[model samples]
Target: MTKEEAPVLLEVRGLAAKAGSAQILKGIDFTVRAGEVHAIMGPNGSGKSTLSKVLAGHPAYEVTAGTARFDGQDLLAMAAEDRARAGFFLSFQYPVEVPGVANAQFLRLAYNSIQGARGRDELDPLEFDDYVREKMKLLEMAPAFLDRSLNTGFSGGEKKRNEILQMALLEPRLAFLDETDSGLDIDALRVVANGVNTLRNDDNAVVLVTHYQRLLNYIVPDYVHVMDGGRLVKTGGKELAIELEARGYDWIQKSAA
Candidate 1:
């Protein structure tokens, strides 16, 4: 397809999602194009995380209405693993710890699994190790980390870096970062942001979900969206985040109402 005819990377149209009987996302619509960064900001319980989970195909979330399209394909119809294999990646706010799986091994397994699904050859352990080492260097991660269990006993900053390392290796077409900067110190935040900035290219896009404007100071998203009460209420550019930081959510709530 020509660049103009190239499918949109991500499109959400009137999406409604729920957990059990309680609705968490109500008729949300947005789109992300190649080489763009979009930030979604909202107060607690505004359904930001629920949107990410629903896009990633979490079983606990039911899509009660509307549709999500990724690369011109039906996103909600795909299984969770299939979503990942189809070039969707999510960096969770709380990464899990697998005690027995060495970090390097886990990375290899994840990388190879995606490659296998795409009909690409899997990398051997040695090749994969070398590959990941290069990616870790971008994050300034130590060689010793490769031998440790995944996220086991890691510091908050370390866990965040580990998540970026996976993102770099996967080289996803679109990445969803859910509250990635929540617990990091200033220095750690810069490190993680640098890693994210480095990975951005014309072929990929990022959607960052955050509650604080501090993270936006570093990543500098091209567009900012405000969400409240399980719906997207407003959208603007980088300046919108500054406005919200200065005025807080009260003004946004009033305007939406």
Candidate 2:
């Protein structure tokens, strides 16, 4: 398909997921197109994170039914690593720390892995260093961060920024940011938002799973969806988020009830 005729980047039809015997997502349906930023906002335990994991093919959660298509390809059929190499990036809310791995080395390995999967020439350390340094500047991260162990002693904000750094490096076609602004301060929030803004292009889209409207203020979404009881209860533009913020979710809960 040409750029104009390219299918939706993401299309979920009656998607349901379960963790062990417990059902988390119940018949969720949504479609995201290129050049769009879609925000999924809801109260706690509303299956926001579950949706992200299921899309990225997390093994612990089983996709009980329904279908998810990414750029006209079957996403569920792809392996987790294959999904990443195929341009699916997930920014975890809680980034893990590696005790002895240097941040630079980890990034180089990830970049090279993606390149290898795409059948592109792998860059040596020297080549990758220059590429990653340019990305770090886009994130406003210091050069010193490259030498430190991955999130070993970094602050919460630092870890989130590091996640964005990975996103920038990977440059996925579709990015799922699960609660990226969870523990960020004002300054860090701005930095992270800026990085996301810079990455926004007509060729990619972002699915932002968030709880607060504050983050929306920074990276405005074209569509805002409210999920409840494992299903999407409402969808609208940025104003919907403001409305929900102004009038708590009680009305939506009552309406659903």
Candidate 3:
């Protein structure tokens, strides 16, 4: 079967979400099939991040209407942790710093938890150390990263790289990276993009939420979607990003209006 014929990994229809009585997503209808890379680009506060968070079962957002199904399971019904265990991942734009937790401890626990959920054998620290270190190398991460506290005292690029490292280890079936390209220098961006590109396969899909077209240059999304006013206004192939980059969102927003 071709990539277009791959199984649907995520399906959303009429999805609306609100945070503290402020309605954010008006109506979102999206679908991602296995093996496709999709990008969501929009202005600030266009609900791009909210859409990812809501789909990932963030507690702050309440689903007021519609449905989201992932891998034939009801995604909204799953808890945040359950969603993660179910092979759904959301890489936050601003990864939180865990002051006391060592990166190795955190990654291993997350990896083993998902492994056990999938009825796979859980790796012990030593075994996991070997496995994870190999995965870290894909992101050009040093061994010292395992010893540092998670996201603590790390540069912006380092934090982003760490996020991609977590992604590599988890190997989620559907990953929604929210503005992962933010705050990274060119070299760092290239590394992160390489890691993401290497992880892509016929069985997994990625949805990137970003503001700049620069990220698209490296990732090369199969589909480029323009989100405006909490809804996806337009969608096209990779060339659409180049057009949006040059023409700006004003015309798109106005046209959508």
Candidate 4:
């Protein structure tokens, strides 16, 4: 059986959301099962990012209406921390830079925090370093990066690779990478996509929110869903992504209607 035939990990029905007074998502609907790599594609300001934020449980975007459940539990009912502990991960488009926090230290704290929440043993700094370094090797990142401040004085590719490193360590059941391809050159894009592809499995699901089809070339998606006018307008296989690349999103709006 395919990912669709597998158990559903996420279910969004009639999802409506807003940023302050301006409404964004309008009755959006979709379902993602375990083992699926779903690509959410659309034009700028088409509520693509908004949908990812809403699903990630961002405080700035309010869920005005609708229901979303993850692993049969209520998603909106859980706190952000709870969501993370429950195996939800979101890699930001623009990974933040911290001047004082070392990458290793930050990752350790985050890892241990989630471990504590899950009633698992927290790794010591030395143990975590060993574990994290092994994971970093998958992304072809150097050990020197661990000593630096988080994303500080790093290239765009380094920042994105760091995000994927965190995802590898967390091993989230549902991972949503928002605009991960933004500002990346071909080399960086391939490296980041390789990391993402490595993490995908038959038991976990990934949702990649991207604008361009170039990223899809490196990481083929099991499903492509188009977002326009604050709602999911179309769903198809990877072919839809290739078509979107050839014809552009303007062709989707008519099909969206």
Candidate with maximal lDDT: 3
Weakest lDDT window of 10 consecutive positions for candidate 2: 1-10
List candidate 1 segments past 4 Å from native: 1-7
Judging by TM-score against the true structure, name the best candidate: 3
TM-score of 3: 0.98
The global C-alpha lDDT for each of the candidates, from Candidate 1 onward, is: 0.93, 0.92, 0.94, 0.90
Per-model TM-score on C-alpha atoms = 0.96, 0.96, 0.98, 0.96
Name the TM-score of candidate 4: 0.96
| Descending-lDDT candidate ranking | 3, 1, 2, 4
The segments of candidate 2 whose C-alpha lies over 4 angstroms from its true place after superposition are 1-6
Candidate 4 per-residue lDDT over residues 53-151, each given as its tens digit: 788888998888999999999999888888888999999888889999999999999999888988999999999989999999898899999999999
RMSD of 1: 1.8
Off by over 4 Å in 3: none
How do these models rank on TM-score, best leading? 3, 4, 1, 2
